[model samples]
Target: MTSQGLSPSDIASVVDALRELRVRSLQSRRRINNPPRLPSRKALGAVVEELAAALFPHRLGADELDDEGIDFFVGYTLDKCFRVLEQQVRRELQFSAEQAGSPVDGIDERAENIVRAFVSRLPDIRVLLDSDIVAAYEGDPAALSVDEVLVCYPGISATLYHRIAHQLHRLGAPLTARVIAEIAHSNTGIDIHPGAQIGPSFFIDHGTGVVIGETAVIGQRVRLYQAVTLGAKRFPADENGVLIKGNARHPIVEDDVVIYAGATILGRITIGAGSTIGGNVWLTRSVPANSHVSQAQTRSEIFDGGAGI
Candidate 1:
């Protein structure tokens, strides 16, 4: 074997195979780009970081900054972050237009509008996130301070990304929103679909293995623990035997509901307000408000010398 890697002929053969695989997978009429020109993940990550720091300037921003410096940092960071976000959103729109064989006219103006709408909603997002931070702080006894919850809690981290993603989803950048959601999921093991409508004051504790599916409607003051799955029990397919999209399959968790860890609530069931679901419960049907559902008690029998053989 030659130095540096595989021989040129072997490399050529592998490249040809990869090309064929790409063509087969994409099945698009458009020519394949070796690296598809999509939204930049790195750029989006940076934008999220900038947004986080901007939202909590004193805490997440650079250390040892005065009030004026904090203001300047927020202004500068938002300007730069929004510009990058616009570019990324433009890329998504461009890719979609090209894929649909549509005109790219007015794409720039549309991207600008979407970004502006997103920017306008920042205050509301921050408000929602503040509620989440407070919820996390109050819900966990071990949590020392609200600042600790804001800075260190995985649930709050996931909620921040989800809140950002939800705004982007509403602003017509679903692809970018999904990417941001996935970034949080990858980091925190919390899968929250951007399409899912979650209300304020939501708290997720020990947030690992939490899955909230698309179309899931979550109400305010809802608390969920680790390994909780609000997922679909079955798939409703089209006449062509293809799975139908956008069906309301996930659960609707009402306000003040507390779902414990390892609880799997499936289907389009309505979990009424103020309900408490015990750990490791596999629930399918709906439960009314103020209800507490738990697994059945285990019955044990001991056989002694006098007992039946």
Candidate 2:
């Protein structure tokens, strides 16, 4: 204790404080008994990185592999990811069943089935991500090539994570999906909910401060810039004033629409196909197809310095 420069009393005090906090947490309903464990964020993040490597074996993968060995590398990576994801999925199912106080029978079989279905869709996910890469390359004049887009664009990284997380969310493993999404959000500063439905050829340029809410539906070839938020205008409350859980709240963005930076489109309103939403626009209502929406005109007047200074 002398060598460590901490007396026994210091350790005792810290332990006592932590115990008090633990007791208080239980009283506040924030701590509960240990049952089946939940999904691990660290393991989920590793699986996501492996999936990304497998999806783009040539671009986002290891540098040591040549073209001839790419197929083998991808296969090996996919197999490894499948095994890890299956375990996590099983944990998630068991935890959920325990929370519901339901029987955990057949959870293993269900988890295996979900993982198999998710793995089978990897090729489709790759195809969708290819379209996203192409969209990013073509939409941004500064982008040099598709390879550059894949390697350098934060938007692409965020979208790839969203695609994987969205698949997990659809398969009823939402906790794991959210963990994966948060990893990408932490890395890219772009927050996309795992439940958001995004279509092919989606391009988000300079993607900092971008937020896409849960239940937001976006269509093909849609382009959005930084600070764009597709959010809920209001929450529907019940008789007791408790906010409703699951309802259509975010905006429905149609195909070929472009939302500029700093724009916020709220509620369940639709942004029609081929429409353009200007920067910093605050929109609440639905616009017709092919429309261009922007803020109202502002008039500036000259002011004399002596007026109020």
Candidate 3:
């Protein structure tokens, strides 16, 4: 106001008037007492990336990383990670407890226990990811080397994140686990929920537009090509017609199943073990083990799609 040439007294009066007006307006307030907050998800993701890189130094962009170097790096990073993650987890849990009108007395202890459980399972998770890489290498004929698969393949990277995040999810750290998994999904076109239960030797070939819904159970040695969707058809609503969450509505791909390109398998139906689902097929029913499903030809067309008829 002074810059605009208003007098000092006039400016002060204007400010007081505005303040009084705001106070009066608050008399009709609809909501109140929202606190200033920090985004826990964003913070958790940043910490997770740091921890992941430390856990897998060479694979995650450490040029000078060796076997001995990796151990030191992991140890150092875990110390820092535990501090930050534990603080954030405790804070988030306290916030949730407060919001639910519950006591936050033991949130600190619970958060520590959760972090310890998650970090302790990292070794097993890494082993599972290695198996996934081996599975991808053995399944794909075009893959030249294991290094190529590990370095360039988005699917493997995403699978690694999924494995780690899934353990956190099982430990009941949903928000932190989701942030880690979504970080992978954003980099890779594969969106697998951390809550999904995936077995060993899972391979995703040319993974793009791959969506594995929450509650989906994928069995061992399952190979899925691009644009495959193992998802639910619809959500069941509650009595008030609002959709419920945490339902087991996704498909279950059994052991040794092969779903080819552009196949969409919807609902909670099970695709039996050793079944081969052909390309560009839509399936809702359960396919028996060792069954091959392909589109039936009604007329002898030119097969202009350039696929095997």
The candidate that wins on TM-score is: 2
RMSD to truth, every model = 5.9, 5.3, 7.0
Descending-TM-score candidate ranking: 2, 1, 3
Clashing pairs in 2: none
lDDT of 2: 0.90
Would you estimate the TM-scores of all the predictions? 0.89, 0.90, 0.82
Give the per-residue lDDT of model 1 (tens digit) for 11-100.
999999998998976667556553357998888988998899999988998899897788899989899988999999999999888878
Model 2 lDDT per residue over 1-309, tens place: 447777899999999999888787766754456634778989998998899999987777899889899999999998899889999999989888877889999999988898999999998999999999999999999999999999899999999999999999999889889989999999999999999999999999999999999999999999999999999999999999999987999999999999999998889999999999989888877888999887651101112333210
Candidates in order have lDDT scores of 0.90, 0.90, 0.81
In model 3, which regions exceed 4 Å deviation?
Answer: 1-41, 66-68, 297-309
Model 2 misplaced regions, further than 4 Å: 1-9, 23-36, 297-309
lDDT of 1 at 8: 91
* lDDT (10s digit) by residue, model 3, range 5-119: 8789999999999977776665555213544233376777778677667656787745787777777887888888888888776766766676677987988899899889888
lDDT of 3: 0.81
